[model samples]
Target: MYKLLIRPLLFLFDPEKVHHFTFSFLKITLRVPFISTIVSRLYQVKDKKLERNLFGLTFKNPVGLAAGFDKNAVLYNDLADFGFGFIEIGTVTPKAQAGNPKKRLFRLPKDKGIINRMGFNNKGVEAAIKQLKNNKKKVLIGGNIGKNTQTTPENYTSDYTTCFKALHPYVDYFVLNVSCPNVSSHAKLEDAAYLKELITEVQKINNQQNIQKPILLKIAPDLNTIQLDEIIDLVNQTKIEGVIASNTSVNREGLKTSTEKLDQIGNGGLSGQPIKEKSTQVIRYLAEKSNKSFPIIGVGGIHSAEDALEKLEAGADLVQIYTGFIYEGAGLVKQINKAILKA
Candidate 1:
């Protein structure tokens, strides 16, 4: 029904606008008494056999909504109705800022992908906390945090630290997002020394907190083997919780989308089907290198049951989706869960 009726209508508008409209509609519909229960029964696949315990947290299943989808931490409970075992919110910063200029988000429907230069456009950590605090669902929530774009690389630690501290009580886990290609200076912080320092600072804060939440690093799929090795070694040394293998990639190679059209879209991380292999490769690399010592949350290009299963087979302790959800709709979650159970 979504693909035949709903998606075609939604596709008529700008991708980002349609996204907001869809969420707003769902939020409104979900408010009606018993609607949430109906939606949950339709979408939420409950299979105890698919349950997973990762990073000291018990997940109802391994499938999760990747960070970018609910940047401000809105719609978590509503989204959980779609059968995701967890929902990661944000790439949220310390301060609220409008992301990139208009058209920062684009759709490549033919390629089953999305290109977004939405430079951490979010309502900031404070607003996210308020929304999260009201969440009624039990699904695990991972907070994906990043520095404000205006903040310099030198002061990056404070930005991450501020967000980490503020969102500590609300989130079940943390994803340090130093690899958002859409932001200008943000990706520069991915250097090993800077990452080490940033993680160290956040870890210090985590230790001081009453409850220590797991911290995971979200990295770009574009890193070289040496960079991957450094990250592996860093994870071992820092004692951080885990890693979300492969954020959206800056690389646009082999895309079926024409260069002229893509250039028109300009710069942003390319996600969806184009990223699956690269993301899985990173997951495999990290898993192989770490010998599964560190948990890996596989993300990027997961649109089907096979994709989700492949990631699990490749070494992901769990998996996440963004473009996959856009292309395949809510049913994707239940499909993945069913696949996990079958596997």
Candidate 2:
């Protein structure tokens, strides 16, 4: 129904506008008493086999909604009804700011993909905390934190720490979003030396708390073996929790989308079906190169149960979905969990 009846209708309008509309639609419909119960019955999958014990928290299932989808920390509780084991919210910054100019999000239906340069355009960390205050605890939540676009280079670590300190109590785990291509000054964030310093600072603050939350790095899929080796070293050196391999791809190679059309859309990170193989390869490399030293949350181009299985088989301890959720509908979560149980 989502693919045939709802997706086609939603795809007709501007992609950004349709995103807000869907958020509102879900918010309104889920509030209609028995509607929540019925939706839960249809989508929820409960099996002891589905639980994933990773880091310190035990996930209800392996499937999660990735960060970009619920940017402000809203809708996670509502989305939990659709049987996700966890939901990651935000690439939130220290201060609120309008992101890149309009027409920044595009869809490539031919490749079952999306290109977005949304620029971490989320409400500031404080706003997210306010929304998260009402957390129902129906699902485990991961907070994805990033620097404000206009933040000075000297303050880059400060920005990540600000969001981390503020969201630590609210979210179960934390993902340092240093690899998003849409953000400004992208090069510094990915620099191995800079990343080490940044992760160390976040860890210092995390240690002060009564309970330390797991910290993970979200990396881009464009990294080669050399970079992947650096990532393994970074994980070992920092001793942070795990890695979410990966975030999105800036590589446009082998896309079925026409060159003229892609050029018109301009620069953005690609997600969904076009990135499945690339994402899995990175996962396999990290797992293999590091001898499976750290847990991995696999994401990128997962549009079906087979895709999720591929991620899991490649050594991802848990998997996340952002574009896949948009393209394959909420049923895909239940589908992946069922397939996990079957396997």
Candidate 3:
């Protein structure tokens, strides 16, 4: 129904606008009494066998909604009804910003992929925390936090520290998001030394709190094997909880989308089918390098049960979906969860 009926209608509008409209509609629909129950009945796949614990949090399943979807905390309850094991919200910054200009999100339908330079446009950490404070659901929520674009790398630790403190009370885990390709200076923070400083600072603050939430680093899919090895070592040295194998790739190699059309869409992270193999490769590398000691949350190009299975087999403790949710709709969660159970 979504691919045939709802998606075509939604795709008719500008991608970003449609995203807002769809979430707004969901927010309204989910507010109605008993609507959540009905939605869950239609979408959720219940199985006690699917429950798994990761980073000290109990997830109903291993599939979660990746960050960048609910950048702010809005619509988490609505999304929770759709059967996701958990939801990671935000790439939120210290302050609210409009992000990049219009037409930043582009759909590459031919490639079953998307190119986005949304620049972490979010309502900021405070606003997200306000929404989260009111949230009543038990579903695990991970906060994917990033620095403001204007913040220089010299003071980057402060930006991550501020966001980490603000969201500490609300989230089940933390994903340091220094790898987004959209923001101009954001990718530069992915340097191993800088990342270690940022993660260490956040860990210091988390330790002071009564409850310490597990913190994981989110990395780009574009890194090479040596760089990945450094990251694995860094994870071991930092004692961070885990790694989100990928954020999104800047690579557009081998995309089915034409050179002319892709060139026209230029400069953003490429996600979906084009990223699946590389993401899995990163997972495999991280898994082997860590000797399977560090848990991995795999995210990139998961559009089917097979894709999810490949990541799991390659060594992912859990998997997340972003572009796949766009292409496969709500059923993707149930499908992946079922496949995991079968395995």
Candidate 4:
């Protein structure tokens, strides 16, 4: 029904506008009594076998809604009815800022993909805390944090640490979102030495707290074996909790989207079906190189149950979906869980 009727209608509007409209629609519709209950019954798949214990937390299922979908943490409870085991909120920063200019988001319907350069346009960590204070504890939540857009190079660490400290009490886990292509100073965030420093500092703050939250590094799929080797070493050296296998790809190779249209859309991180293989390959390489020493939350381009299984087979402890959720609708989450149980 969603793919045939709802999605087509939603697709007629601007992609970003549709996102906001959908969020508003869900927020309004889910609040009606019995609606959430019915939605839950239809979409949620619950089984002991579906539960995933990773990084000292148990996810109801291995499937999660990736960050940028619920950027402000507003729709988590409403979205939870759709059967995701967890929801990652925000590529949030210390301060609120409008992301890139207009048309920073684009859809590749033919390719089942999306391209976005939305440079962390969030309502900052404070607003997120207020929304989180309303947490019904309906689903596990991960905080994906990043540096502010105009933040100077010297204060980059400060921006992240500030958000980490502020959001620590609210989120179940932390994702140092370093690989987003929309953000500034992309190279510095990926630098092995700098990552070690950042993780160590965040770990320091975590230890100071009564209960430390798990910290995971989010990386890009575009990294080669050598860069991935650095990632393995970084994880080993820093002793951070885990890693989210990928963020989004800057690569435009083999896209079905026309070159002329892509040129008009301009540069941004590409995601969805186009990067599925690339993400799986990255997960396999990291898991292989690390000797399966740390947990991995695989994400990027998962559009079906087979895609989720491929990542799990390649050594992902869990999986996340963003573009897939947009393209396939809420049913996809339940589909992946059933497939997991069947497999």
Candidate 5:
């Protein structure tokens, strides 16, 4: 029904616009009596086998909605009805800023992918905190936080520290986002020394609190083996909780999209099917090299139960979806959980 009826209609409008419209649509329709209950019954699969206890929090399932989808905390409870075990909100910055220029988001339907240079556009963390405080659902939540666009590399620690502290009480875990290709100067923070310093600083703050929340790193899929090795080493050294194996890829190879149209789409990180293999390779590498020393949340281009299984086989403790959800709809979550149960 989604691909045949809803997706086609949603796909007709601008990708970003459609995102907003769908959120609004869900927000209103979900408020109708028994709507959420019906959605939960249809989408949610309850089984002890699907539970994942990681970072001291229990996930109802391993399938999660990736960060950019619920950039703010507005739709998490509504989206949780779609059967995701968890929802990651925000690549949120400390201060509100408009991300890159218009048309920073594009769809590569032929490739079953999306190219976005959204540059961490989000309402400031304060607004998200208000929403988080009001959340009525028991679904697990992860906060993917980043420095503002104009923040300097030297001052990056403070930005992350600010967000970490602000969101600590609300989020189940925190993902330090330092690998978004859309943000200029942000990738430099991925340097081993820089990452180690940043994580250590955030860890310092976490330890000060009564209960420390798990902190994870989100990396790009484009890194070389050596870079990934460094990242693994940093994770071990920093004692950060885990890693979210990818954000998106700057590489455009193996895409089925036409060159002319892609050129028009321009510079941005590419995600979806074009990234599945690459992201899986990164996860496999990190898990093997580290001897599975730490947990990894696998994401990028998961469009089916098979795709989710491949990540789990390759050593991901859990998995997430964005583009796949866009292409496959809410049923993908149930399919993944059922596959995990069958396996």
Candidate 6:
């Protein structure tokens, strides 16, 4: 119904507007009696075979909602009803800032992809904390945190530490993001030396707490083998739990979208199908290079069960969906889980 009906309709309006509308619609409809129950029955898959224990937390399954979609924590419970084993909230910053202006999100339907320069626009950490504290479900949540847009790399660790301290109690795991192409100078933190220092500083704070949450890095798909090797070494050195093997890609190579239209769309991280292969390649490289030394959460352009399987086969311990959920609808999650069972 989504591809043939709902998606076609939703695709007509501005992508950002439709995103908010869908959230509002779900929030309102979910309030009706038995709605959540019915949705859960239709979408949820219960199977002990799919359970996974990684980074000290157990996931009901490997499918997760990637960050950026639920930039804040508002719709995590509602989204979880759609059969996700876990949900990752935010590329949230220390301070809430209006991201890049209007039209920051673009859909490339022909390519089954999306381009977004939303710039980590989230309602800061405090707002998400309120929602996290209110969470009633036992669903596993991963917090994907980032620095404020205006913050320079020199003092960026402070932003991450602030968010880490604030959200550590609430989220099940943490993803340190420094690969977002939309944020100015964010990539500077991705340098091996800088990343090592940043991760070390965060670890120092994490050690002070009695119970330390697993910390992972959200890297870009654009990294070369040398960079991936350095990251693997850093993970081993820092003893941070894992890595989310890819954020979106800045490369526009081989897109089916028309050049004129893509050019008009301008600069942003290109996600969905265009980056699937690249993401999986990164996962494979990291897994092979490190000899599967640590866990990796795979994400990028997963639009089907096969796509998810490919990620797993390439050595991703868990997989996440952002554009896939947008293109394939919620049923895709259930479908992927069923595929995992059959596999």
lDDT of 2 by residue, 1-343 (tens): 9999999988999999999999999999998999988999999999988999989899999999999899998799899999999999998999997899998999999999999999989889999999999999999999999999889999999999999999988999999999999998899999999999999999999999999999999999999899999999999999989999888788899999999999999999999999999999999999998999999999999999999999999999999998988888999999999999998
lDDT, candidate 4, 71-158, per-residue tens: 9989998999999999999988998999999989999999999999998999999999999999999999999999999999889999
Q: Please say which candidate is ahead in TM-score: 2 or 3.
A: 2
Which wins on lDDT, candidate 3 or candidate 4? 4
Question: Across residues 258-332, which tens digit of lDDT does each residue of candidate 3 receive?
Answer: 999988988998899999999999999999877998899999999999999999999999999999999889999
Runs in model 3 lying further than 4 Å from the true structure: none
Local accuracy by lDDT, each model? 0.90, 0.94, 0.90, 0.93, 0.92, 0.92
Model 1: lowest-lDDT 10 consecutive positions: 182-191
* Higher-ranked by lDDT: 1 or 5: 5
Q: CA lDDT of 118 in candidate 1? A: 89
Model 1: colliding residue pairs:
none
**Error at 48, model 1, angstroms:** 1.7
Clashes of 1: 0
> For model 2, what is the alpha-carbon lDDT of residue 8?
94
In candidate 2, how many Å is residue 158 off? 0.4
How far out, in Å, is residue 201 in model 2? Answer: 0.6
RMSD of each predicted structure:
1.0, 0.7, 1.1, 0.7, 0.9, 0.8
With candidate 5 superimposed using the best TM-score fit, by how many Å does residue 61's alpha carbon deviate from the native?
0.8
| TM-score for all models, in order of appearance | 0.98, 0.99, 0.98, 0.99, 0.99, 0.99
For residue 81, model 4's alpha carbon misses the true position, in angstroms, by 0.8
Q: How well does model 4 score by local distance difference test? A: 0.93
**Candidate 4 Cα misplacement greater than 4 A, ranges:** none
Model 1 segments beyond 4 Å from truth? none
